[model samples]
Target: MCSLFRCSSASSLLLAFGMAVVTASPVVMSIPISAQNAVPTLLTSTSKTTFSDIKANYWARPFIQAIVERNIIDGFADGTFRPDRPVKRAEFAVMLQKAFEQKRVRQLNAGGFKDVPPNYWAASAIKEAYETGFMPGYPANLFLPKQQVGKFEAIAALANGLGLTATAPASNILNGSYTDAPIIPNYAADAVAAATQANLVVNYPNVKKLDPLEPLTRASAAALLYQALVWQERVEPLPSNLKTANYIVADVNQNNQTPNDVVTVTASDSSFSILSSLLKTAGLAVILQHPNNSMTIFAPTDEAFANLPKGTLEWLQQPENRETLIRVLTYHVVPRKRQVSELSEGKLKTFAGKAVNIQVNSLTHQTTVNNAKILQSNIQASNGIIHAINQVLIPPNINLSKK
Candidate 1:
């Protein structure tokens, strides 16, 4: 839905996504889904008989592992993940369908496909898969389940399944070429383009080329599935359990139903040094003291701080740029804490008082936060939670939030 930019190495991005890549912890602010939204109750798939026997070493291990963790896919009692075993068309269709339970189940006729008979075990899933455009038909109406799925076919299936596409920023077109143009099959141009724009497809060893149409390997499938979940907003690392040791603040009086906020966010204990410095510099310490005020703050990591335009931070440190800094900081916050589950597809308000329009796929964990990923989230706290954001937020209109 939105163009994606490669922000950092996997370790760096994973650190933001809760994989703990950083050593510096941020201050223990209020736990927030975005604002003081989510508090405690933390946060899908099913297994199929077709995958009766799967081994851990199978290339599908990662895909199976992720979907399994999310409850989207399951395994047999014996504990096996079959990677090379071709998925029966019906079975593959069902697995795909299960991954996107967010959309209303597509309506289905009694039967679907030439090979998928009425008695076929996967009729329902295949039908849903086809209707959703995840698995379109070939030149003929046949869906040959017995025959193994090819490479490009699978890519098309997944790209369509999650409704993801990509593009380049007008400003960053000169950054670098990331896909191989010729090898990408003609039919997959748009899909590849979409993937590239979304930062979904990265050239392996070469950013400017894509070996499109090649049979996607089992490992590749796992990588793609992980990306899809990231894209869909389904898979999020749970907020790190924080030790509530420092602040003496009392919890807000609890008369209200928790605000229906999206993106509950919290900061890392390790990032406290960086967090404190920014708060002091932004002159937001007073806001932290006010008990009645409800807020959401998107704090930048040390890396974000380091990358600021030269003298930019020093200028913001001046009185004239105070509002600019506040607007930048506020742009990171929303009114309430919203975990990935609560984000509706559309524009949302930020503390900076500007609007950030986004396209979200709640099922796949696919999210584009103004072209960046939430990376890490739901860090718990007392006042409001923090979501570690990648690119610094700079709302276009600082005055918008004031009114």
Candidate 2:
């Protein structure tokens, strides 16, 4: 459906694709020109090579390391992986050259792109990408090589290049799985659906919110590329235990599970009625609905609120006490998605700028957030994760006195 390079005629010719080591999905890793420290010793995939910025608990470490081990991407000279950086179109093209090895599917006049001069550094990569049917130029033969590529563009390229097609209608597939499905560009619907079917899409924090138009980040690009490699049978999949594995999008239609945003997830479930009401009253529920946000909510159950001291809930709901209510409610939220397995005996900073002490009983395998026991854990939503607790967690230094 992509208008690039006559999708109608080219789609037929490019439909036949052969797998190889390096293909362009999105450049999940890159070596910046300033990375003079990118030596073979530092960039190799061995255990000794580590990026300073990628921590043990970082969500994308496994994918990034996997790509690094394959020599598909490299870290910076400064030892920092800079996983948050936006990947450019040219960089993605270069990565495509190194990451996939599919035989040419269709030949395009790569030289027609005026932007990529003959001596441009990425000229060959762009040409290869175009000729191989991984990435093609714009309507005007414009390959905006330096532009920041969005997730939709990246996945579309991968799906197009791999000759992936959606078995179901793109709209149905997208609407069923993603909260932000309406915003997905019409041109990318089929490719996005195909990529989703192939499990080539990896969304961290929330699995259901595609955030399709967001600029592709380095770590995210790596995850996408890794999945593509796995699809091609060119690389081993990530260990099942890794947090990164949880982010990979499975075959939703086959799985028969449609994901919803955090607020919707809470509102639909009768158990969260008390907590859901409080979030709405405190004007915090809308925040959770944002497709781009990745948060974790430690929701206290309705019974938990019932367990509160007599008149305690009533007093907190007073309009005058709204600020205190906001603080207490926000104490249950962390700005990032954290799975149950990721929680340990430590302090987790909350959205209210306070920290909650976590205690995990090793032998009993029971977890406690502050004084509240974790009644339920790892209730996933499109924009966040949710863990139900047995009691409300009041932040420190909040004045509960009614006005």
Q: TM-scores across all candidates?
A: 0.42, 0.54
What's the residue-level lDDT of 329 in candidate 1?
Answer: 62
Best-fitting candidate, measured by lDDT?
2
- Separate clash counts for every candidate: 81, 10
RMSD of 2: 21.5
> Local distance difference test, per candidate?
0.47, 0.74
lDDT of 2 by residue, 111-186 (tens): 5588877877777778888877788788877988778899999999988776565545688788877889899999
In angstroms, how far off is 221's CA in candidate 1? 3.0
RMSD of each: 17.4, 21.5
Model 1, 103-204: lDDT tens digits are 432444444566667665566666777777677665566776545455456656776555543222312321233324445466765554444333344223
- For candidate 2, what is the lDDT? 0.74
User: By TM-score, how accurate is candidate 2?
Assistant: 0.54
